[model samples]
Target: MAEKRTDRALDRTELIKQTTLELAQELGFTKLSIEAVAARAGVGKHTIYRRWPSKGALFLDALLPADAQALDIPNTGDIEADLRTQTYAAVDLLGRPPFGPLYQALLGEAQHDPSVAAALNERFIGPQAQRVRARLKLAQRQGQVAPELDLDLAFAILSGPLYFQFLIAQEIVTHGYIDRVFSALFAGMRPSP
Candidate 1:
């Protein structure tokens, strides 16, 4: 009996997350509401509230995968190749429908909502940044990156232009632009002779 109850609860939670994703795709994040999610999922508002404190939190949970490797930078024995591979993958993720638009909407909302901002940073941005920094540190030790380079600054330099094009310019991140950014960044990051 207890096993059945646990299965039911897990099923309900999955339902809630799937319903939230569907609604976010249809309505976008700005218009997504907890009430609507609960109604759509056929659960009480309190059920969702028990699971997630805010719409942003719930949306974020629904948006990202539990598999951390989805965003991990591969060690290909070449730092530039690895970075480019990861950047291309990231651009592909942000360029697709539902994912791209919904993520963009949440990013826009985070600008004005501290809770949302904190949640985004805590769950998504911070973890991703940490992974990038770790990859850079590995490259530094491998003699691919300059030993004296600041990992945090290196991360910002690599990601900043992509974010500018992604969020500010609201333009699709082209392969050409990505190549240019890497070319310039690698020029500076390469170990001195």
Candidate 2:
């Protein structure tokens, strides 16, 4: 039946993505190749090309979770607790092996490749920024944050330091650092007495 072919195609796509990630874990992105992916996935190189345009595109698809909920910022009434939970989760994800290094490699690649940068923003970074802004808006509605606060700036304030510590300063994002950041940031953003 026609449906059988569709199911097989979906299975093959999943296999290709899985193989890509496994290879990326072993070799890292710089050494990974489409030919190796095809060979590992037991599919022709044409199959991967049909699904994605380049190595970056293929890895992007493989790296990001299919579920949007994976990146959700929770709402637990206490804005500080909620945001801290989400922030901790984000930091944990960014520090995990295979994914962490692979994602960093993608970011490095994006600096020179506009298309890759655009895709990374569209698929991952932009959504996360939107989610942070949305959570801040909710906190504002609940009187936890200043009503007049610029949420765009709030988002930057929250995420900027974390990345700077990780990627720029090359320092570990310890729990103590996160706690300190939250304490300082919340002091500035909270509603005035």
Candidate 3:
């Protein structure tokens, strides 16, 4: 039956995801290969290729837990609180295994593989950023943010430091960092009386 086939397909998909995660945990992202994933999943290489164009598309993304995907970021009444929540969530996403190393590898790989770069931009950064963008839009609507506020700059200002600390400076993003960053940006965003 079609339903049976669908169920079976879903099962295989999950199996592959779990296998990939386990393998990445054991192998780390640099040593992980698509051929290994296929072998471990007990599926043909083409099965994965059919779903994702490259290891860049499948390997890192398959292992990301659903919440870490930023698919449904909450928009609580307080935009400041929501931004803080999402910033912490983003930190959590990058700090985790598989996602962290894979992201690092992809950044290196992307220099040579344009497809990998596109996948990273499309699947990873752009999607996660939408949550923050949505929060900014809401703030604009609620008048917490100045009407003329540049949302992109606002987003970058708010998030860039956290990422810089984590990804570039390789420093800890303490809770104090979040509070200070938000308080400063919020001051800049509030409309002039």
Candidate 4:
């Protein structure tokens, strides 16, 4: 009986998370409310509050998977190949229904809201940024990149175009585009003979 209750609790938490993302996709994160999430999840508002303290916290919970890749960089002995793999993963993540718009919405919100910015930076961006930086250092050790390569600039070169297309150009982020991004950017960044 206790085990059944625990299973039910897990099911309820998942239901809340799913409904929150679904409604957030439909309604926009900024427009989504705890009341709506609770109503859709078929739970009381306190249930959500018990899990997440604020709208930002709830939405950040939903944001986790979108940014999960940031912490998981592959080391294939070939930096270029690893980057292609990672970029392709990002393309898939961004091309999905909720993530692209949700990401854009979050960025817009981050522009003015300190709490949102803090949440994104501390919980989302910082970890990934460190991971990428570490990956660049790995590339350096592997002689796949220049010993003198500016890690920050290299990362910017790798990710900046993708972000620009996603946020500014509002263009499609395809695997083909990822291919182009990897080819064009890394071609120039590869270590000199």
Candidate 5:
């Protein structure tokens, strides 16, 4: 009986989290409130407070995907092809509606809120960056890239143009842009005389 009760509680918490994310997507995080989330989740405000200490914490949890799969890079051992694949995946992630808006809001809020900034960095940015760095290191070892190339700088070189188009220019980061960038970057940074 106690086990069943615990399962029910866990289910309710999951529902609350899902509902909160939906609400946050529809209404910006700044306008979201515990009462609104509780109403959407069909739970009491106390239930939310019992689980999360602050709005930022709850919002952070909500922003996370339900399954939360890690970004996977294909290891074809062809540096340029692998990078193009990774760039496309990144553009796809950034172009999704709710996810895009939520990320933009997070970036904006992070500028003002230290706690939110830390949570965003820890949850999203750091893990993705680590994976990319590892891939870059592998490419270097394979002699597919220049030995003296900086991994961090390389990532910026590849992603910066996309970021400028999407975040600043409010333009779609198209397939053509990805191909062009990948071609240019790989050509300039290839291991050669």
Candidate 6:
């Protein structure tokens, strides 16, 4: 009997998470409310609060995939090639409208809500940022990048232009743009005199 109750609880949580994500995708995170999420999930508002104390916590939980795929960064032994691969992947992600809107909403909310910002930074940004840092370290080890290159700055250089083009300029991130950025970054960071 106890096991059955636990199973039901798990099922309810999964249902709520799925419903919240679907609603967030359809209606922008800024417009999502606990009452609406509860209605869509077919669960009571109290039930959601019991699982997560606040809407931000619940939203973060829903944002994460239950079977999230791990990113596989290629180590082609050519640092510039690997950086280009990573940057292109980021461009692809930013170009998708559904996800793009969701991210924009979250970022905007994060500006006002520290708790939500912390959760977003911890769960979403931190891991991806670490991946980029690791890739930079690998390049340094391979003697492809300058020994004194500031990795944080390198990351900015690799991703900043792409974000500007996609999010600000409202331009499509193309292969040519990625190639141009890669060329510029390599020119600056390549082993120098």
The most accurate candidate by lDDT is: 1
Against the true structure, candidate 5 has what lDDT?
0.82
Candidate 6 has its poorest 10 consecutive residues by lDDT at 63-72
Superposed by TM-score, candidate 6 places the C-alpha of residue 86 at a distance from the truth, in angstroms, of 2.3
Question: On a 0 to 100 scale, what is the lDDT of residue 48 in model 1?
Answer: 96
Q: Can you rank all candidates by TM-score, best first?
A: 1, 2, 5, 6, 4, 3
Best by TM-score: 1
**Residue-level lDDT tens digits of model 1 in 14-74:** 8998999999988877789999999988999999999888887787778774554457788
lDDT of 6 by residue, 97-180 (tens): 666666666666777788878887777677777888898888888888898999988888777887687667868888888998
Model 1 RMSD, rounded to 1 decimal: 1.6
Residue-by-residue lDDT tens digits, candidate 4, 1-193? 9999999987988888788888888888878999999998889999889987778767766766443645367888888887778777777887887787887877886777777788888876777677778988998888887788888887778778888999999998888888887788777777899
Residue 18 lDDT in candidate 1:
93
Clashes of 2: 0
Candidate 4, residue 127: how far the Cα is off, in Å: 2.7
Q: Give the TM-score of candidate 5.
A: 0.87
> lDDT per residue, candidate 5, 64-134, as tens digits?
65367766778998878877887788788878887777777667767777887787778777777787888
Q: Give RMSD to native, each candidate.
A: 1.6, 1.6, 3.1, 3.0, 2.1, 2.2
Better of 1 and 2 by lDDT: 1
Q: Whose lDDT is higher: candidate 4's or candidate 6's?
A: 4
The positional error of residue 58 in candidate 1, measured at the CA in angstroms, is: 1.0
Candidate 6 clashing pairs? none
- In TM-score terms, candidate 4 sits at 0.80
All candidates' lDDT scores?
0.88, 0.88, 0.75, 0.80, 0.82, 0.79
Q: Which portions of model 4 miss their true places by more than 4 Å?
A: 1-11, 65-71
For model 3, the stretches where C-alpha displacement exceeds 4 angstroms are 64-76, 96-112
